[model samples]
Target: MDERKIRVVVAKPGLDGHDRGAKVVARALRDAGMEVVYTGLRQTPEQIVETVLQEDADAVGISILSGAHTFYFTKIIGLLKEKDAGDIIVFGGGVIPDKDIPGLLEAGAGAVFGPGTPTSVCVEWLEKAVADKRAKEQ
Candidate 1:
């Protein structure tokens, strides 16, 4: 496999104004040596998907606390499939209820982190996930 940094797009699904969690995770991912592109704030699902394709990102991490997690995740994942980019990993973190996790996963979210989960956990998982994905492509 070619030796290249894993690229990721971190987005705040355009609805909620709060992006503290998104910023924190973006910094952690960057610190972990991944190439991270943070889509400032209030990004529509369409914009986020566009960035992922433009960056050739291996994954996208969405930070949503707007109680719109299901809506955004389903829409983004569907859009990716429509774009024939379903192989791109879609993971996220935010204030989400436990009951909604399975539905999110079913909708094609690779994983979902809840509030207070350690950022290191996200980084480790993402690194492994992207590495595995790259290996499979090879």
Candidate 2:
């Protein structure tokens, strides 16, 4: 298999203005040798999915703190499915409650990171998930 750097789109979907975490995660992914495209703040689900398609991302990382994770994640996942891009892994992070983690996963999120999650953990997960996805594609 040809080795290729994983491509990821980091987006903030919703009205939330806090982006320190998103920027941090994006940087972390870049530092880990992955290509990271950050969509900035207040992006709608459609916009995020569009970015993913345009970037041909292997995965998407959404950072939300507006307490609307369920709605935003569900819509993003649904849009990806509709676009036949559901193979693009989706993960989330923010002030998500523990109780909502399961629902988020069930909604098609591969993983959820709560506040205080180490950037390395996110990087590690992406590395593994992207590798697994590539293996499956082959």
Q: Which predicted model would earn the best TM-score?
A: 2
Q: Per-residue CA lDDT of candidate 1, range 48-122, in tens?
A: 999999999999999988899999999999999999999999999898999999999999998999998999999
Residue 81's lDDT in candidate 2: 100
**Residue-wise lDDT of candidate 2 within 1-138, one digit each (tens)?**
648989999999988998999999999999999999999988999999999999999999999988999999999999999999999999989998899999999989999999998999999998899989999999
* Regions of candidate 1 where Cα sits further than 4 Å from its true position: none
Global local distance difference test of model 2: 0.94
C-alpha lDDT of all candidate models, in order: 0.93, 0.94
For model 2 the local lDDT of residue 91 reads 97
Leading candidate by lDDT: 2
